[model samples]
Target: MWPRGDDDIIRSNSLHESWSTGALNIDMLFPTDYFLFQVAVCSALLSAVSPLRPAYSTALENALRNELFVDRNYSLLQRPSQQVDVRVSLTLLTVNELNVKDQFLSESGYLSFSWQDSRLSWSNTSATSQDYSNIDSLFSTELYVWTPALIIENSIQDMSVISDTKIPMRITQDGWVFWSPSGVYKVSCESDITYYPMDTQTCYLKISTWGYSKSEIGLSLEIGTPVDDSFYRENGEWDLLSVAGHPPIVNARKGTWYSSLGFSVTLRRKPIFHVINTLFPVILMGFLIPMVYKLPTDSGEKMGYCLTVLLAYAVYLTLISDDIPSTSKTVCLLSVYLGLTLTFSTVSVNIVIYILYAHFEGDKEVPAWIDNGVRKFGRFTRREKRDQNKVKPSTKEEHCDDKKLTAILENEENNNEEHKPITYREYSDILNTFFFVLYMAAMIILTIIFLLPLLINYLTNG
Candidate 1:
């Protein structure tokens, strides 16, 4: 009689029935139920000889056939039979050609991957059906949606890339697609039989594709290694090995596969020759104006010329603001040049006013009362006209006698001497001296306030 348990009856019937009958009945029973009973009996008989079996013979055979398998789906079969865990590694190669759409606004580069595997599973342990759809869309490709944990290591040091082969890439209506001469492969078991097997086995997958017209690219690998609680116990640290290849010539850096490869681009203003051409002349003009102050103020034309330069600098300052970014902190050299020009122009104005005033007003003698008080303190004083008048000839009595002397002196002077009138040239000389002294003083004060502070600030910041 058949055993009481349905499972025992299935197993016994499978062993005793003819092959044709059993094959026909196999579909009637649940495949898992039949496989479980067979596995129990097989475990008892094959435990001693199981170690002798090849570690990855079926997996290697699949690899030779250009077929790849992952461990996730296979785990369900192994779990019922309590089989040993298995691990496998695969390598993939991809070549990419890129074309940048906007060279001024964007840049282009290529990505090459050396090793890629299909066994690694994602870390979304609590993923719901919605989460799975989201993640699948994120990493889906035109040919297949690989649920593998991709590890990327960037060998490019100077440049950065956006995606590697094993990235969470998604397909959109306008999204990138992968094309291969060999058709794409889907998930499958390593066994030649159509039914899932209870035996434990590991498989490796190698995928190769080229990414063209890409903004940036990188390389990475995937594996079936599970990340447990201990994996996250410490900081998530991963060590990645790099395959053989020369580093990219562009701005690149050596990076590890433990983290995702990332890239970001910014639009920068290109250095324009026309902009420099426009600015260079303006800055030169501003600097040149300060030198005009060195011309002697006696030239009389200095003030008019300096005013014209100051106006030009102001106009240039207005124009420059349109080109440079508003948030830039750098004080333009042009601004400094314009400031110096304006300051010197102000000094020029002061000098012109001073000279014009001194020209009109000659030095006036201090009043007698003020002079007397000043002299009491023992300060030096100029001789007053009153003091000179006091020394006039006291001999009025000799006036009559002097009158005869004066008449004879007048007669001799009229015959031998001619009188010359005095010129205002002395006043002009005095005005020049005073105005120059004032100019020197103003310059000294400006230097103390503006130049010294600038020097101190520069040195401290530097």
Candidate 2:
């Protein structure tokens, strides 16, 4: 019913129809149609390529061995031997979006990436779908070939580049790529964000990719909102993302990147200590020196020793100030020392005044008005009473004789005693050297406890 060439075509058409229609009659009439049709197709292919069979067979075997046809189903009729070239590339971009949730501090920025496949289309003269698909395969198979770099740029003069050389990039089914170089970044202070001296301004991060591809290379950056975690990292590790880069410039400055990730830190001014050391010892010692005034003036060591403490405090003040910074805001513990020293000097001055007054006035009993008002209100009641009471009256008549006469006699006696002052040896037993030693000990202890902490806080914080 059909010609020879038409017979093969008719047979192929009938077989296809029976297969598609699932005909029960074909199963009985042509039980071997599927097998026969496959044989006929193989015979025709072999006859048509018989002259180049060897060349074609070798090429087909090479392609299969090379895994070029792994995605195709193979049959005896026709063997595919075509191979495509896949090209790939990766690019990194810097992201500059502010993170609103955070105060622009912790987790301030991260790396992100954009991936593109060039093997989606096949072409020799120009890139085709096959070329894109092949390029994508390279990405899928060689996920470890990608690396990321972060480029930081801002309005400030100092911009730093943060790099994590150990990035591992992997492509997902949808062609999205991801990676992260975990760490916090330190951005320079900005003035526009806040007026405070230490206010942190705007900062951003970008994600990028690095790799060895030519055609299929691409990168994308996502701008992150500013955040505030300036103190420390909330999570132990940096979050994972793609290509990371710095945000846009808010205020630029000269900057370099240091490899610390825990917190953003800054330096403060150091505290001065010279004044504190000098004054504290003097004041503490000075307070106790007044106690020495309680001793009789006849005691040779009282004034001399008090004078020595005053001089020592002055010397300490001068020495300590040399080491302190002139512009420091905090009052040095040394200043406290100096204050104490000056206070003791004042006490010494009081002692000197008391001794001079005692020596020049003689043992005349003080006048009732002088005793009740001036001496009592002037902070010298005890000394005045003791000095005036030492001399005895000759008689009741002499004591009551004209009050003026008594006063004159007392003055003459006080002047005579001043003219014949007591020697240091005669009053040595009355002097208490132990009080001076105790004063020094208290000062040392107080300095150690109070001054040390202030100094430590100043130095550490500052």
Candidate 3:
């Protein structure tokens, strides 16, 4: 008889009743056979009503682990094959910062690396009677498995190999291994600041197999989009234009070939920030430079005004210079514009000094050439006004009065043989008017030449 515990007392009583009710005929079996049948029936019923036993997941994992890695000699430094082809892909997460002055790009992302290992492959029931066919994959780490050593080719930060034993690597039943590791990566990039705030920069994130030759471990991108930006967050100061992956490039050095894959991130400056903060002010000051001549000489702010504008241009140039690398390979157009405007301000200051000297030179006779030029310009303007006002005389009386006035003017001109010379004040006034118009025209032309292209680019591409 099977031993019964207090927990099975109720079940035993129910079974006795079922037997007494003739559910099983006692005469149909012999005494020993009935006892054996009772034991068999009770065992089956207990098993059917009992709670489920623990699964064989841990056992299957232990078996698979022992079969695959226990004695497989999977060395981290060793490749699975002499020529293992690694499939590499990148997914961009965030464009943290791009330092134009330092010529570097900082970003956060992960890399998906996949390759096959023939040694780790196994059938579903290789180690036990239980069918582990439901198990699709297994997990391991770099500590106990062989993984390709891939690294950023142009990294500026940590140059060490990527290895984290804590991160689990997925291994499939068919020996396919997939590993994804993520971190912040910084890479060297060439900055082209020619258009400056209106520029579009393409920076590359390059990857390579470290310590492995191109023949030892080939690198290829997956067939789909290799550089995925589906999870990208927009940068406030920059707009992402495109992200593209390039085919593997075979590079040779010192009689050795290395394989590298590249992904290009094209970004354009948002321009609104720079336009309001930098370019707009520079332009506004360019126009303000001509106003120095408009201020009265006696107001005592002529020199101060000119110096103030020169100082403003200097400050703006310094500010913009901080954003670009100090490289001679390319010069920013905005810098050139600022320099030219600064020079114009300097010229205006010198002109102010000269004008003050003329104003203080009391009663000085203007030179013959100066007096003649000023008088000729003044007379030409007056003559044009007179012609516009003149009209034909309609009455005989008006004609006689016009003839009389003409005769009197001719006699007065003949009598005044020697006229007074031009004064210093008049010469100063002439110089002021001429330079005001000249400077205004110059400022407008400079805006059109240096700044129009920037505006056009901003409008077209913003």
Top candidate when judged by lDDT against the true structure:
3
For model 3, how does the per-residue alpha-carbon lDDT over 330-398 read when each residue is reduced to its tens digit? 888888898899999989989988977776775687888876676656533221121222334457646
Q: State each candidate's clash count.
A: 13, 83, 0
Model 2 ranges off by over 4 Å: 1-286, 311-325, 328-337, 340-347, 350-357, 364-380, 383-462
Ranking by lDDT: 3, 2, 1
Judged by TM-score relative to the true structure, which candidate is superior, 1 or 3? 3
Cα deviation of 201, candidate 1, in Å: 56
lDDT for each residue of candidate 1 in 156-235, tens digit (9 for 90 to 100): 22222223433433322222222111211122212211100111112112221122111223323223321112211111
Shift in Å, residue 281, candidate 2: 6.6
Name the candidate, 2 or 3, with the larger lDDT value: 3
Which structure among the candidates has the greatest TM-score? 3
Model 1 Cα shift for residue 420 (angstroms): 21
The TM-score-based order of candidates, best leading, equals 3, 2, 1
Estimate, for each residue in 129-193, the C-alpha lDDT of model 2 and write its tens digit. 12222223212222223222334332132244444545555544333444444444433332221
Provide the TM-score for each candidate, comma-separated.
Answer: 0.30, 0.31, 0.77
Model 3 misplaced stretches (Cα beyond 4 Å):
1-56, 71-73, 123-132, 372-421, 459-462
Model 2: lDDT to the true structure: 0.39
